[model samples]
Target: MAAVLSVYLDLALGLVVTFLLLSLLVSGINEAVVRLLSIRSKFLWAYLRDTMDGAGPHGSWLPTRVVDVFRTMPFLRDPRPAHEARPAPASAGEVPETGTGASMINLLYERVREIDHGKQGRTSIAEIPPARFAVAVMELAAANGDVEGLLARLKQMGSPLYGHLKGVWESAQGDLDRFRKGVESWFDGEMERLSMLYKRYAKWVLAVLGVAVTLLFSMDGLEYAKTLLRDDAFRASVTAVAGSGQGAYDELKARCTGAGDPVTCVTETLSEPALVKLMGQALVSVSLPADGEPEVRWNGGAWWDRVSTPSHWPGFVLTSVALLFGAPFWWDVLRRIAGLRSRR
Candidate 1:
């Protein structure tokens, strides 16, 4: 029985490994496909531009829509005369910069006004037009000859416009910083999520395989049952009924094993009423022993006896570890999958 169980267990382990590997492969393929399909050259360019602008003394967070638009337009990234970087005209301050920075400052003021009636359109450091502000900085830069001194003066001037431009520039810098942080966070989160997902998948496959192993291992119990059926005492009882040489056989034939219950080895032997009565009398004379005393059969001998075996300890430890650690991970994955499907 133990040998048979071991064979089944080994097969189950193999199946579990196969399933786990398959799940990992599937997940990897899915990740790769998503990466491949999401090749956003335009988005990359926009990101780079935003990065550059932020790095410049005057850029802010680009709008999500701008990112989306760039993603949709493949040629947007390609260099063109219009797209080429041109130095801001020293006098372009009169014309408003029309993009993320301007839009964000406007949006911020609008939101602030909505929340505070008394503070309606309060001049924030974010609203100074970049070009106008850049000209101011250039003038400061030319006057001071030292970029650091110019920056320091701008920081010291403390006018609402100066403050707003500085705030906007700082805010842009902050946003770019945040984007870098977000990228790192996202990569870490994604890698962690994938690892957890794989571990969970592995566990679930192992569980199903474990159940199958248990079922296969229980097959030995069926064989034991068969052995019980073929016991000498059971056969003798059946033989004695057959020996009752009379019409008993015909009558009791219909009463042999009612409903084919293997536990009760009796079978219908006759159909005739008189013969059935005779067969019944003969069965009564054949007395079988009561059920044998219950026994606990250990596969690897007593627990202590098998503890010293190298295979026994490792197998036991691994199985225990798998069950203890793997269950929660598996449950989490199932929950996540359920959540994802629900969203869909």
Candidate 2:
């Protein structure tokens, strides 16, 4: 019984190392992606812009549009802002500078006014239905008197949303009916584009993180497996514990996917020195001379010597490729390997 337990303990310890390596790689990749692209900040900025500029019956959080209040006319207030009284120079030619700045709030304000009042600033533009947008794109289109000019202005605005709209307009080919369809179709494509962008960048980030983590921990999965298999003493120890049958395997599986955190649960049970010992063995087992000790520190000398050894390259490549398969894959493998005790 003790021999069987010892054998399983070794396997459990090995699993702990794998789990920590996976956790480190995944988390490190996430951090790098977020830092490199500021994904959260950009997401928040877009959310706030949409909320503040809301035009639906349920949205628009600000009070009274432009606060047009009089002794008797508070409810009859104009939707224009107080700044509307001055607007900006050549108000005809002056559209809001609402891109990539606090001006989006100001842009949303102007848009609300246009929606409430009219598009053309007169009955003609007003008669056109209120198009849904925070920026006065329709007003700009009306003011420019041509869809082409408005599309140009949208591109120059530097807002990704508006740039998307411009793309919609261009694809419509000057037919108003086609333009409406273009807008809808373009939106769906852009949504897909956003998803693909994340996946593409995430893989790049993950690869970088995997390399860094592999080096830091000196993990070489193929080499470790080879050494463990060849070591009759080590193999016999684990096989005995594994012979305890289904119940023991189930227990190991539970610990691998432990309640709080599989990685953390395993880590807390293993010592730092124990892990270092395992990693160091994996890193240099091939070159390790019969007279030499396996307790070598990871350094340039160790790496150079290991790589220069005749048989270490395949093991090194295999280890890197195993890591590329990611944590979930190995976790499943670990569970299956543990469950094998019952079948035997």
Candidate 3:
């Protein structure tokens, strides 16, 4: 009974390792792609456009500077001519006269300008409290436009990002405190969305790698299971090795976990293949072919012959899904079974 249990357990562990190895390879590849593609910068740029300054270069203004009081400071603007130092800058409203929304830096700049009360230009989104943003919106409502009308105008002006926040403002019903809280919550939600997107990317990477690894190894989980059940000698041999803990298992574990980069793992470990070659090399007692049977090379059968076989598809699928459980899962199960064997 113990040997039989170990047979099933050993097969499960092997499949799990295959999946885990593939998953690691995918992660390593993802890191490489991220490094080479610099995709995060694109996402950052998109996020900035979608949520931040929607009135910059690709925004409402052209690449050249605007001459209005809202003109951006080009790192080195004339020293106010010394003879003609004008009121710093002003927006087109009864609001404070420091800076306006015309040629702002980013969404942060626009947000800060709307909220500045002292005309001091000291407050900014980076440091100013969330309360100030609320104050600015209230000021806009009081002097320039009503909140609802302003939002409607923004939507019309391609500021669709703000449109999503319409409900928060509406529910606030002109209550500054509640509206401020809602704005904070909305920002939090966007951050959470970004996190989820990264996680989703990782999952996709793992899935693609899993498929590749399973095919490369030609490991059919269902077929492996079937083999263990039907062949008593092979099954007993595998159970003995698994229960005692194979040295190759440790080597695989160490190589996989120790390799800093997954590319190296592929070159060093997977280069020789797993199930097809490693089985014979690592286990003396686990050869599938009878001593007299011919040992065929390179997966033995031709492409269509193996793929078209009805028995092949299900096992391949089972192996793929088993990988989704990940390496940690199989490792844990294998350890628990080993412990049971030690006690018995």
Candidate 4:
């Protein structure tokens, strides 16, 4: 019974470690693709337009005078081109800024821009907090004295923005604070839906990256498990490496603290160099089939025979599916399995 349990532990630990390494590689590649394409920014921009101007086909959403306010906001009014680097912030109490920077919308755009591109500034802001966005919209709606007057104007103009503000006003029961909170809640709900769509898109990216990484690395999930179970020396080496890396994993986890977005946290935490180093450590335990000669000779056997008898499709699929679970899931499993083994 003890011997069987030992074999099981070895197999589990080795497989978990392997999956964790593969997850890091796939995740990093996916993040790179996302960054290159500016996927998050695109999604956020689309959401902003749709929410402000009602759902419609892709194009500029500035039809109404109020909606055009987005283009005239403090940040948007800069004469400098979009590609130019933003000027450094004013030093101490000295204010040499040419633009009147008293807009909350400017602060929100700057904050979101910083989050998306680090210190770099871009014309397009990726993320807008629901609370800030709601406040900005309310301010725009009430630009001329009161919301009722704006709603009267909005009705004449047949603007979609009127319906959104009217609903919030009715729900607020005449309380100004309640109206603001209601607007925040409404925007927050929309953002939640956007988050779901973003996650769905991310899953597709993960699936593609997972398969590519599996094929490139020759990671066959079934074959790896079989090898670990059958080869005691290799299994021990993998288990040892996996166990010794606990401190590194813990440190990485610590660094992920206060990362508001989970996906961003993962991508930034397992950076390119870190992923390469970890994968290198994991690969040192066992050689992949790609590192070896073909088991079936192309000249000796028929092409169909070679393809059918020694095909890696099943193994590739298995590994790819395993990687979709991501690194954090496998890391937790590794920790639990290690604890179980230690207790025995």
Candidate 5:
């Protein structure tokens, strides 16, 4: 029983470590994709437009004006006047401050055009504090901090937003500060929901990326596992690395948590030459096949057929599915297995 348990623990540890490494690689790639596309900023922009749209009986003119204020938010604007600011496109035309509905709609069009052509970093703001967001909206809705005017305008718009603000205003007993706080709290709730929505999107990204990585590396999880179970030396080496206490996952986690932005931290950390060299050396030490040998090889028959052959399909699917569990999950499993093995 004791010998059987030891073998099982070694197998579990080896599998967990393999999954963990693959997950880290995929995660780094995923983070790069998310950052490159600026998905967070896109969602934020869409949410603000929809929230301000009001969908009232009023024409698009009113909603357009409200949405235009979004670009002027302090967070979105660059303070540097001398940074060679690009002029808004000529086609957009100059919007006159006529205070007429027609002029307001035109101004909204201008804002949209500018945003579409805006310099990348200047237009993409992924985060906005709840308080600042609430304050900006309140200022836009109410001219000169006039509560009555704000209420009148919102009510005139006939949107659900008006009712939402009215409830907050009443709860504050007409105190401007309290009303601002209420709005901020509401923004927080909306952001929480937005976060969940983003997570769902991220899961889809992970699934696609997982399949891509499995294909690129020709990673065969089942074949690798079978090899590890049968080869005493390979299994021992892999298990020893898992039991080393200090691991790539733990180190990456620590460095990323300390940085201002986790995504950027990960990108930089994984790009370090020393870290990459170390990882490469470790893999080589265990005689881990660098380009998918002993299972799938590059030179065998047609390249596509080599990977797509039915025997390799199960391994490919298993590897991709394991990746969806993510690095952190496998890291925890590795740690627990190592701890159990140590106890005996």
Candidate 6:
């Protein structure tokens, strides 16, 4: 019984170890796949943002439209001189002091319209011909391709257009830099946040799967124990102990008593098909008899007495230990097989 139990115990232990290994393998494979796919922080953030912000092809444009409005029309402008200039004449409810490059462009277009109207009327300003002045200014601005130098030249010419142009240019440069830095920082932060979230999600999924596998194996182990306890040979062995009070030895002695030499009698009893079958069955069962079953006993001075030793208690303990450790490993092996098949 001990030998049989030792074998079963070995099997169970192997199975538990196999299960642990399989779990590790599954987790490693999942992580490797994720890494290989490059499904990291940046990708997660972009996916989430596009999904939530409705910027993708199938998405609504409402959020983006609102954001565009806010970006184009900030509530406050910088108090610096660059942002406090304008070319457009002050109108009702208009701040006369503050204008931007966009305002200057608007002013230029308005002036051109006025010149064209005057020319049609045959009363064009000859000293500062509008077309010539516009062309010359455009050429000068393009010559150096330096926006600040062009604004300075315009300022020397002392037009509201100069101040407006300079203010708009300077403000745009600072605002552009600030906006760029803010976008970069936000992108970086979002990536980090998404990376951590994914890691936690993966960890939780792995943990849950591991626990589920363990529970399944535990149930299997319990079923195995039940099967072992219910074997026919096990039932018969237990009954023999209760009836004869000496288990297999008592039965053997009773059968051997009148069969000539004591050694021959013992051998003949052991060789009986039924007894051999019982021993074989006992070896496999390995479970203890149910509670209240009689203890095994043998003749006071016989070798059989030494062999009985109360009951098959040791076998039961060893078997239990083997199964306790082996079930998880066996479950793991089964899981690995399943995983391999799935991959295929």
Q: Give one digit per residue, the lDDT tens place, for model 4 in 123-178.
A: 54556777776665555445535667656655554445568879988988777788
Off by over 4 Å in 1: 4-8, 24-28, 31-35, 38-50, 54-344
Q: Kindly report which residue stretches of model 6 are placed more than 4 angstroms away from their true locations once superposed.
A: 1-22, 35-42, 45-53, 57-181, 200-344
CA shift of 99, model 1, Å: 8.3
Candidate 3 per-residue lDDT over residues 1-344, each given as its tens digit: 89667666766665555556655555576567654443443333344344533644444321123331123221222111011112323442432223245311233344454433321222211233445545545555445466665565555555545565587888888876787688767766665675565555556555666766656555566665554444444334344546875743544444468678855663544334335443332212133443576654453354335455678788768767776666666656666755634334
Better of 1 and 6 by lDDT: 6
* Candidate 4 Cα misplacement greater than 4 A, ranges: 55-124, 153-159, 233-310, 340-344
Which is better, 1 or 5, measured by lDDT? 5
Once fitted onto the true fold, the runs of candidate 2 whose alpha carbons sit more than 4 angstroms away are 1-20, 26-30, 36-185, 230-232, 235-276, 281-300, 307-310, 332-344
Best by lDDT: 5
Supply candidate 2's per-residue lDDT for 83. 33
Deviation from native of the Cα of residue 308 in model 1, angstroms: 50
Q: What's the TM for model 4?
A: 0.60
Query: What's the lDDT for all of these models?
Result: 0.35, 0.47, 0.49, 0.57, 0.58, 0.39
Candidate 6 lDDT by residue in tens digits, 31-85: 6754433333223323332322223343422222333222321221111011112
Cα miss at 109, model 5 (Å)?
A: 15
The predictions' CA RMSDs to the true structure, in order, are 22.7, 17.8, 15.2, 16.0, 14.7, 26.0
For candidate 6, the 10 contiguous residues with the lowest summed lDDT are 75-84
| Model 6 CA lDDT for position 110 | 30
Where does candidate 3 have its weakest 10-residue lDDT segment?
A: 76-85
Candidate 3 has what TM-score? 0.46
Model 3: colliding residue pairs: 53-107
Candidate 3: residue 254 Cα off by (Å): 34
